[model samples]
Target: MPLLDATATHPITLPDGTLYRDTVYLKNVISHPRMEIGEYSYFTHCGKPEDTAEILAPYLGHSVRERLVIGKFVQIARGSYFITSSANHPMTGFTTYPFRIFKPETFGYKDLPVKDTVVGHDVWIGHDAAIMPGVQIGAGAIVAAASVVARDVPPYAVVGGNPATVIRMRYSPEIISALLDIAWWDWPVEKIETNLAFLETGDLAALKMA
Candidate 1:
């Protein structure tokens, strides 16, 4: 049987061949206009499949200017959520209270600068991780559980803690560059399957040859 099915909302089949309802392919479940999700990006949550976008990013409204862009093969564990630019209060003022929001016609704060949140391909976000707005997580990055990521993460970095800091780079600069160049995630599924051994084993030489 083929390993990946892009159309399957519940993609993970258990050992007993029963579908796991807690995980869903984000692309198949999410239909938000402000969000752009790549194929095979799965989000593990206990919420309804149709509410995946809302649960993942509660503050990203349909009318919001900023977008949530998630790339392919990303694995997001349960309890992880994104705090988009829209979630920000009027921090520039003396009082953080949003007085303008009380009136229907004067729902201000539209002028607040908003930036998109981007998650790169093959990233693994751990449980209860909180990604702040405008943060760009590079491909193959691993965000530790309960992390609060406020800054951009480099490719293949392992980050942890509040205001997440890079714990370490998964590979040396030379190897990281080569992997980025290889970009196996962009390859056809069949080709990827054929080279799965190299990917799983971290055989860079073999992958380069593939």
Candidate 2:
């Protein structure tokens, strides 16, 4: 049997068997490349068209510039925005206005600082949240609603607020370590399916036995 039902029109199966669809409202209106969505990761918009997710500031005409990488089983809620580039104008000059942006001869794309925004496995990014440029979110982190994350978030942390701050760790270090070692997201589909109950119960022994 095929890992994906390719006959579906909207959400297509990615190479890793993840069901993915671009934010339909942004199609043709925006320049985002098709995201490398990991297995079982999906966006929940709560039926609001205005709530959307896209790669921020994709390079003009497929030039391989955007480097946002979201990992397996990442749950991104509606209205979450990932800032992919610094795009800071030459701030050292007298005026902040980007004179270089309009002047082709003066334009220097390389002068601006930009980096990848990487979301690790099993991350939960909340509604209307904004992930700032170069932020690396660790595995199993929970970013609360309306948070603006500007820095790196450690694994299994519960973060909230604008310019997000860590509220607490989800588990003790040992449990978090064990979970990381297990890396359930890397398991085969069949095995994942069979062990679904263990996820709810946090039955590490059962999962290990399987």
Task: Give per-candidate clash totals.
Answer: 0, 0
The best candidate by lDDT is: 1
TM-score of each: 0.98, 0.75
Could you give candidate 1's per-residue lDDT for residues 1-210 as a string of tens digits? 779998998999999999999999999998899999999999999999998999999999998899999999999999999999989888887999988889989876888999999999999999999999999999999999999999999999999999899999999999999999999999999899999999999999999999
lDDT of candidate 2 at residue 20, scale 0 to 100:
56
What TM value does model 2 have? 0.75
Model 1 root mean square deviation, Cα atoms: 0.8
- Give per-residue lDDT, candidate 1, residue 84: 97
- Tens digit of per-residue lDDT, candidate 2, span 3-90: 4322232344568977455423232222345344465565644343333433333232233354667787777776777766634456
